[model samples]
Target: MQTILIIEDEKDLAELVAFNLEREGFRVMTAHDGLTGLDQASRIKPDLVILDLMLPGLLGTEVCKTMKRNEKTAAIPVLMLTAKGEEIDKVVGFEVGAEDYVVKPFSTRELILRVRALLRRAATPPSPGSVVKVGPLTLDVERHSVAIDGAEVSFTSTEFKLLHILVQRQGRLQSREVLLRDVWGYAFVEDSRTVDTHITRLRGKMGAAGELIRTVRGFGYKIEL
Candidate 1:
């Protein structure tokens, strides 16, 4: 069973979420503060983390940043739960390494669906023995690793998948909607800005090779050789 850690300060809400997730057959763990959540995540290394945006002691963003910086727990996906639904807020959450986000006053059904989706994506194994080369970037699809100019670089699963799709398609301009569907496994995304955010992050991590991922301005993005 996949273990999920819920880091929420609101005890009642956290228990409610834990109850539902446990019913879904997942092993659930809860933390009422960001610091505790961070520590628990490091110790337990759950498959996924349900992080509340606002927490006492440490903010959710800080906790996520720290987790991503740590080698032990960095690969675990994070799904941010927040009351703030602004575009910028979601952008910031993604920037901090959240794989997905759910706004406040969300329905239990939607929350469960999002959690399942994230886990599904995480469980997907990369196709073996396939490698794609774009400029100096080498993507070994089998190993789920990327290297730029022979130097290995770390990427979130979301970032890795996004890069894989773009490079696989090569030179094709993929609209945000298409990327959202293909890369994020979302049929309909509320805010396609999520694509842009991941693209930006992908580019940043690619360093000088990032220039190969060109912005198509009014459309979306494309990988140019």
Candidate 2:
């Protein structure tokens, strides 16, 4: 069974989510504060984490950043929960390495669907020993690792998947909707800005090699040599 960690300060809500997830046949763990959540994440290394944007001991963003920095836990997918639905808030959450975001007042069914989608995406098998090289970028798809000009770089699971798709379809224009569906496993596209935020971060992480990913102007993105 896949383990899911819920790092939410609201005891009632956290328990509610845990209950539903358990009913869905997942092993659930809960933490009421960000620091405890981080500790538990490092210790348990859950398959997926449901993190709240606001927490008492530490902010959820900090918890995610720390996890992304740690090699052991960096690849775990994080689904952020927040009451704020502003675009900037979502951008911040994505920037901090969250693989998905859910605004509060959301239905239990919606959350569950998202949870399942993230898990499915994370569980997708990569082609064995498949490596793609474009300019100064090299991606080992099977190992889920990236190297730029012989120097290794760390990428969150979501970022790596997004990059993998772009490189796989290199020279082909991918619309925001297509990217959201393919990379994120979202059946319906809510906001395409999520794709934008991740693309921006992907570029920054790639440094100059980021130029290999080109913007199609008012459309989406593509990879080119």
Model 1 RMSD vs true structure: 2.5
Each prediction's TM-score against the native? 0.85, 0.87
> What is the alpha-carbon lDDT for the whole of candidate 1?
0.89
Clashing pairs in 2: none
Q: What is the lDDT of residue 179 in candidate 2?
A: 94
How far residue 115's Cα lies from its native spot in candidate 2, in Å, is 0.8
How much lDDT does each candidate structure score? 0.89, 0.91
Residue-level lDDT of model 1, residues 13-99, one tens digit each, is 999999999999999999999999999999999999999999999999999999999999988989999998887888788887899
What TM-score does structure 1 among the candidates reach?
0.85
Report, for all candidates in order, the number of backbone clashes: 0, 0
| Model 2 stretches with alpha carbons more than 4 Å out | none
lDDT of 2 by residue, 1-225 (tens): 999999999999999999999999999999999999999999999999999999999999999999988989987999999898888898788888899999998899989988988999888887567878998999998778999998999887788889999998999999999998898877556668888888988999999999999998889999998
